[model samples]
Target: MHRLANPTRFLRLCNMVKPWAMAITLLCLATGLYFSLFKSPPDYQQSDTVRIMYVHVPAAWMAMFCYSAMALSSAAALIWGHLVAQLIAKATAPIGASFTFLALITGSLWGKPMWGTWWVWDARLTSVLILFFLYLGFIVLHDAFDDTSRGARAASILAVVGAVNVPIIKFSVDWWNTLHQPASVVKLDGPAIHSSMLVPLLLMACGYTGFYLWMLIVRMRAEFNSNKIRAIRIRQANR
Candidate 1:
């Protein structure tokens, strides 16, 4: 991590990885969609509505994944004073929020047909809603101060603290009576889901992961450039 602290080296690395990330994202999403929409068998109960799982499940997973990334990055920034880590946490906010929003929207759509309702206050649903708000809060807190460093510090602390929600969201269904189903793919034994559905679901997850990585690099690059420009302006004003 420290080795890549140099802005030039970091940017060079981003340039190298960006194209591969994009390629993986495109390939995986295309293949995943094909398998999910065309090849995968429909659920006996949910039927066509089950197709929405491909999108909703992956989006939900990515939402938590992104928040975890942000929390780790924020911790590094606060503990080690790594500017790049700070920028990374900052860059991740909107993307994480976007993923959370996607999850919520898709989940609602899926729920309407399956549960006969558009919303629920079940443990999983409520906790995920809280997670979404946490993302928004992080973004708002980060820009709330005139002193950028102070704002960053405040936001980083919030991120680290809010990370407690991730696990709560994960375990909510297990811990409480809920409309949400228990874990199917990720389990102590093995995936309860059939290979037909599991394969495309896994593919979609990989695609979402690649998309997040690609977007992270792009956003980090933009954030880095913006910081540089801000520094230059400050220097000019001082001069």
Candidate 2:
């Protein structure tokens, strides 16, 4: 992690790994979609509509996972004063927000058929909505300050603080009676989901993970370059 403090070396590693990440993302998406839609047997209850789980579940997972990542990055930035870490957290906000949005939209599509309503104020749903707002709030707070460093610090603090919502989102269904179902893929007694559905679900989750990595590296590089350009312009102005 400390080695990654050097921006040039970090950029080099990202460039090397990016192509492989993209290739794997495409492969997983193709295979996962095929298995999820065509090969896997539908849930006896939800039948065809269960296919939305492939998209919704993974997006929800990524939304939570990316926020956790941001929180950790924020902690690192605050502790070690690493600008790279701060940039990572900043770049991650939009992607996490996007995944959160997908999860909400897809979950709504899944919910209407099963629950007979387009929306509900369920615990899990509400907590995830809070998570989405937290992401947006981080972005808004970051831009609210005139000094970019001050903005990053403020955003980092919010990211760290908002992490409390993650567990609430994860356990809300179990803790309260809700329209959302309890854990199917993750449980102490092993997964309750069938192997056929599980395989594609895991594949899509892996693909989404790769997609996030690919996006992160690309966005970080862009941020680094932009910062450098800004610095150069400042130097020229001072001269």
Candidate 3:
């Protein structure tokens, strides 16, 4: 871990990882889509509309996963003063926001056909929406100040605080009456979903995770380069 804290060493590791991440992302997404669209049987009740679950459920899962990762990274950055951890938290925000937005849009699309509404203020839906705003807030706060460290600290604080919403989003349906369905795939007894449906869902989830990793490496590399350039400019100016 200490060795990886060095930016050059981290970049070397990322160079090795980026290709594998991209490959896994492509393979999983392709296979998952094929199974989700053709092999898996549609829900008897929702018919063809059930196909939306393949995209929506995985996306919602990724949204929370990414945010949780961001919060943890932020905490690490603050507690240990890890620059790479700070970069990771910064890199993760936009991707997490994208995932959250995707989830909300897909959720609404799925909801329309089943619930007969395009939107709802239910606990699950509302909490996820708050999560989306939290992502945006972090991104904004991180760049709001001219002093970059100050901005980063502010954003990190926000991320750590906003993490409280993750549990709420996850348990919202169980805690309160809501239009959203309760846990079917992550139950204590094990997934209630059939193998046919579960396979593609898991595949898509893996694909999403791979995609995040690929993009995070790319973004972190860019950030490291930018910081290096900025440091050089400051040194030359002083000289």
Candidate 4:
């Protein structure tokens, strides 16, 4: 990690990995979509409407996972003054935000058919909503200051603070009486979901994760180039 901390090295590594990551993301998405749309069986209860879980559950997972990554990177930035960590957190924000939005939209879509409502203030839903706001807040705070370093520091603090919500989002169904269903795929005893449904759901989750990595690497490379250009321009202005 330290060896790849240099921006030039990071850019080179990203260039090398980008094509492979993009390929894998596409492949996984294709296979996953086939499994999700064609191969998977409908839920005994919800019927066709349960199909939304493939997209909604994975997006919700990524939303939490991405924010957790950001928080860890932000902590590294604050404690170790790691520029790459800060860049990673910065690069991950919009992607995480998009995942949160997808989760919310798809959850709402799934809800209307299953729950007979488009929205709810249930603990699970509300916590995920708060997660979305945290992402938005991180973006806004990161750009709010004239001094970029100061802004980054402030955003890092917020990221770390907001991280407390991740676990809440994950366990909200268990912790509170809510409209949301409890865990099906991940549980202490074993997966409650049937193998037929679980396989497609797992594939879709992996696809979403790969997609996030592919986008994150691209965004990080662009951000590194933008910073380099800004530095060069500043040097020219000084000269």
- The TM-scores of all predictions, comma-separated, are 0.98, 0.98, 0.97, 0.96
- Pitting candidate 1 against candidate 3, the one with the higher lDDT is 3
lDDT of 3 by residue, 1-239 (tens): 77887888999999999999999999999999999999999887899898898889888998999999999989999999899999999999999999999999999999998999999999999999999999999999999999999999999999999999999999999999998989999889999988998999999998998999999999998899888898999899999
lDDT of 1 by residue, 32-132 (tens): 99999999998999998888999999999999999999999999999998999988889888999999999999999999989999998999999889988
Better of 3 and 4 by TM-score: 3
Model 2 segments beyond 4 Å from truth? none
State each model's CA lDDT, in order. Answer: 0.92, 0.94, 0.94, 0.91
- lDDT of model 3, residue 36: 94
Give lDDT tens digits, candidate 4, residues 85-180. Answer: 899999999999999999999999999999999999999999999999999999999999988899999999999999999999888999999999
Q: Give the poorly placed runs of model 4, Cα more than 4 Å off.
A: none
Q: If both were scored by lDDT, which would come out higher, candidate 1 or candidate 2?
A: 2
Q: Identify the runs in model 3 with alpha carbons over 4 angstroms from their true place.
A: none
- Pairing residues by index, what is the TM-score of model 1? 0.98
**In what order do the candidates fall by lDDT, top score first?**
2, 3, 1, 4
Candidate 1 residue 188 Cα shift, in angstroms, is: 1.1
Clashing pairs in 4: none
TM-score of 3: 0.97
